[model samples]
Every structure is written in structure tokens, then in C-alpha cells.
Target: MIIPDAESIAQARSIVLAALSEAHAKHAGRGFDPYEFGADVSPLVNAYAALTILEKEEPSELAEESSPED
Candidate 1:
């Protein structure tokens, strides 16, 4: 029952994407093959993933579609 402060849709999307990307890198690096043209002893496919990872973990509430007006 983790009640994360209700974030906007965009914010939630960012979190999921970041987690998936990390899992891929750790898995991908394990699968690296030096014989291949694009390979490495400690491979990395973060290719702009660092750039893509949202600077803000939570986006502004303004991203919300609609909310009950007080």
C-alpha cells in the first residue's frame, strides 16, 4: 500500500520507462559479444537514455488532464 503522492499521467509514464530502460541495460551488457562489430567487454546501450531519462522524477501537476474544481 504505497500511496505515492498522486502524480500526473506524464510523471507516472516517466517512472515506468526509466525502470524498463535500466533493466535492459543490465541485461544487454550481460549479453554483449566482442566478436560482433558493435560490442564491448562492458557494453552500454544507454544511447541517450541518460538524455531521455526525465530530469524530474515527477512532472508538474499541470500535466493532469482534468481535476475537480474546488
Candidate 2:
């Protein structure tokens, strides 16, 4: 039963995205193909997916919906 706080989840999302971006940059240098690092980077894909679910379920900001008069 691991419950993460909102702040922690947000921080994790940011860190994961940053790490993925850095990893991609490293893979692109010296003619290195991304496929060669698929195994190592695949977990990031899952992280993105998990974050998406969390974001949708627990959005940081919610817009108020206006109701039309009948």
C-alpha cells in the first residue's frame, strides 16, 4: 500500500521526463542508435504511462465548468 503525495508525483513526472530527454540526447551522439538502448530506456516508457494516468486522475488544476440556464 504505497501512497504517493501530490507533490512527490509531480516531482517524479518532471524528473522522469528530464531523464528521458537526457538519455535520448546521449543515445543520439556519436552515431549511436536508440534501439541499442531499448532495454534500459523501456522503463521510462512505462513511467510516462503511469504518470499520464496519475495526471488524469489527479490533475493539478481543474477548470470550472459553466452551466447553461435552462
**Per-residue error (Å), model 1, residue 31:** 1.5
Query: Candidate 2's error at 64, in angstroms?
Result: 28
TM-scores of the candidates in the order shown:
0.35, 0.64
Candidate 1 has an lDDT of 0.46
Clashing pairs in 1: none
What are the per-residue Cα lDDT tens digits for candidate 2 across 1-70? 3445677888998999898888888887757775776866789979988877766763323221233347
Which window of ten consecutive residues has the lowest lDDT sum in model 2? 58-67
Task: Show how many residue pairs clash in every candidate, following the order shown.
Answer: 0, 0
- TM-score of candidate 2 versus the correct structure, residues matched by position: 0.64
* Candidate 2 error regions (>4 Å): 58-70
TM-score of candidate 1 against the unseen true structure: 0.35
Model 2: lDDT of residue 21: 87
